[model samples]
Target: MQTHELIKALAADSRRTGVAMNTVWWGAVLVAIVVATTIFFALLGPRPDIAIAAQTVRFLFKFVVTIALAASAFALLRMLSRPETDPRGLLPYLVIAPALILTGVAIELIAAPAETWSSRLIGTNSLVCLTFIPLIGIGPLALLLLALRHGAPSHPALAGAIAGLAAGGIAATFYASHCTDDSPLFVATWYTIAITILALFGALGGRVAARW
Candidate 1:
């Protein structure tokens, strides 16, 4: 082949790789969201008093936490999907959601009475939260793992773990609207547990499926 032709072919491959990765990533996210949203509404929905609930700071704050987590995880997963990118630069973002939840927990403890702490942490929907978040997040996690398969992730386990986080965030965002529990204590405890299950699954899935 001619020298110029070889250079052009290489450039074309590079562009195609970038575009293909982006397309699959975005498509995975969209399909995941649709699957999650459909499952959430089919089985559960925004609480009856969501309008009144929306007026409260505590209720509003949980969405902020979930959105932050999802957004940060999505960004990190993108970096992890690319073999050439150093994902460490985005590692700090993973801390943001936890930090926000912790801050909320601190505020709640100081502002609310001590006697209510256990109840808030335990909450009324402990069983429901545990059951549904993982249930909803599973679909998203699978979709994300498929995307990782399409891309070349240097560390499939790590990439899969981040995929879990992203799926959990998306699942939690929808679940929060349905949950009546507004305390940060409940969120920090139950939401974390639910999301952790999905992350663990993602890690396992990655190790099994994302290799090569």
Candidate 2:
């Protein structure tokens, strides 16, 4: 309300500069895909029988969950990048993927016998799942954290975490193709853990990078 405060605010606004948020975000999306895909191929490409795998509902479901997560997190992170955006209204979107995964899990539990449940959850590549999702995601996470610095986010840490979620989703989508484990149980457990790791890293990175 004061003249000095008004001048200071105007000065701050003037100092903010660069590409439009849309341009920056879309650019980040493309770059992230490149970065994640590069890592995926270098580490592990799609499974050998992906053509056959494509026929299964469970195999296809992995993409549905991962893409949903990426889309939701991307939308929220974009909102969080702006100081004026509330982000709360969009919070529900984040749960959609998780809920879908849970539903898949429930369906899996019902369809499969109890004896096989443990094997389904454990999977053949639990270690690989843990290792590569984070590995592939780290680059995109860093990219997003850096991108967040371009905007005046009120919740830098949260924004960074969402960036990680987006990165995780992207990584998982690629990883899912190569993964032999198609059970929802495996995805719900291992995939969630892998993504959470990236989210944690993103939070720390956000705290440091997005700080004003």
Candidate 3:
């Protein structure tokens, strides 16, 4: 068969099976990572030390969540590649949470003054509002992606809200590992704000992506 025919055949198979290439690829990656991690943990057995156990669990959690985020990012990219449809409609919200939270952290790192950055690196009690402020944009950007894709304005707000929540949760997981504050007040304050932006991104994007 000709190359064009093969391409057509593959596209048809993909649509018929309702499986996107990135989805399958990332799914396999996730499965492999999970299997490897499981095997490693099993081989190692349980550590008697509490700190070891805690660290092991934390690493596992991070690995799993990272896989999830990768899968979600693939889904979003798949949606972007296709024409606007229900499945595509869902991708922005699926991927936005992790994207935004990471972005917020990046912003935090960028905005910190040299001394403050050094202090925070050393686990000081310094607070940087600048770091937290840019995270607020993550959710909005998620919504923007949806809007740009859909070209309508119906459900961006709701989408943004959900995206924010997802982003915040993912962000908190990493923060939980590194953050020394360990205080409900700190999490409730900063993490809450970060996720709130994710939600807004969904809401704003919902309508934008709806354009048919």
TM-score of each: 0.92, 0.91, 0.37
On lDDT, the stronger of 2 and 3 is: 2
On lDDT, the stronger of 1 and 3 is 1
What is the lDDT, from 0 to 100, of the residue 151 in candidate 3? Answer: 23
Residue 18 in model 3: lDDT: 59
Candidate 2 lDDT, 1-212, residue by residue in tens? 97556545634663474346677888888899999999999989999999999999999999999999998999888878766556677779799899999999999999999999999999999999999999999988888887888887777888888998999999999999999999999999999999999999998898899876
The CA lDDT of each predicted structure is: 0.91, 0.89, 0.42
Highest lDDT against the true fold, candidate: 1
TM-score of 3: 0.37
Residue-wise C-alpha lDDT for candidate 3, range 1-212, written one tens digit per residue: 97556545645555665544444534433443344344334433233453553555333443344335434643443443333234445755565445544554455567656566544443332243224322423433343344334222223444334434434344434334444432232333554555455555545554455333
Model 3: per-residue Cα lDDT at residue 53: 38
Off by over 4 Å in 3: 1-17, 21-156
| Clash statistics: count for each candidate | 0, 0, 34
> Rank order by TM-score, top first?
1, 2, 3
Better TM-score candidate (1, 3): 1
